[model samples]
Target: MKYPTFEDVKKARETLKDVSTSHWVQDDLFTWKWWLLLAATFLPWVIWIKYRDKERTLEILCYGLLWAILASATDVIGGESLLWGYPDKLLPMVPPLFPADISVIPVSYMFIYQYTNTLKRYLVFSLLLSGFFSYIVEPIFIKLEMFALHNWAHTYSFIGFFILSLIPYYLIKKLTIKK
Candidate 1:
């Protein structure tokens, strides 16, 4: 079997990228699901802005940024590993479900961090939030044909969500500069 050359692999990748772009334009762009995804991408930030703690805005935003990084990275890994996928995309150039990674996950956890003042409260709320994300939101996405899971399950997602929310909070708590 002849292995493809680097240039050949690059050419194939470009072709696949074009296919994705074309598919997005033809099948995804401006569809109802696309509109929903667009709203999901932006609406949370609006809500967050309205509700986020004014005094702790910077700290909350930092936690959100960290969660976004972790969520986006994990989504990329999961997609690449064929553990899950998004059939419809708001933008083909991004991770399949960037609205979730970039907006929903971060915003939800940021709110939890902002509202939950004690470690016990944080843990309880975060666990509940993770369960909601894994069991409720994910199923809704699957029903809408937005997301699919292959080599994964809701339990795994629950664990991932829990860790993703917890790590950032602890890191922020540890690193915050006392005035």
Candidate 2:
């Protein structure tokens, strides 16, 4: 089969403009609501990173980056599916994908990983943390228009995020053990 030409791809992208325009709005135009949500989402990460061990700071940063990507991917998919949404006012004038929600989640996970020593204990704690965040913090976000759940209402089902977090933790532990 012949590949589509650049012109054809350009036309297709233009056609998709309406679907993507909301993501391109000016960032500095944020409202008070946006600032409040941003503070709540980002402050904890800043405080935790400040107190983190110097030697392990790089490790935590790396893990934070990885989990940020994971969370971004999930957020994108969820946004496309109408399972959730973020207000355009909440994002800064940067990469369209750079939202506060994505930035915060991985750092939170890194904090959990750093504070706990054992996999079993970390897993349990992480699950509880995920449940609390999902049930409590997320609903407030929902109210603030940072996100919107579609067919599925948010619940304390830490199983999914726990499993997602477990994979990296397990791999990290195994590699550290081997070394």
lDDT of each: 0.94, 0.66
User: How much is 40 displaced in model 1, in angstroms?
Assistant: 0.7
Per-residue alpha-carbon lDDT of model 1 for 1-179, expressed as tens digits? 99999999999999999999999999999999999999999999999999989999999999999999999999999999999988899998988889988999999999999999898999999999999999999999899888899999999999999988888999999989587
Candidate 2 is scored at a TM of 0.74
Candidate 2 lDDT by residue in tens digits, 121-175:
8978888878876788778777766556675556623555676687667666665
Please give the lDDT score at residue 75 for candidate 2: 62
Mark the 10 consecutive residues where model 1 has the least summed lDDT.
170-179
lDDT of 2: 0.66
- Looking at candidate 1, what is the lDDT of residue 19? 97
TM-score of each: 0.96, 0.74
Deviation from native of the Cα of residue 103 in model 2, angstroms: 2.7
Cand. 1 Cα-lDDT: 0.94
Backbone clashes, each candidate? 0, 0
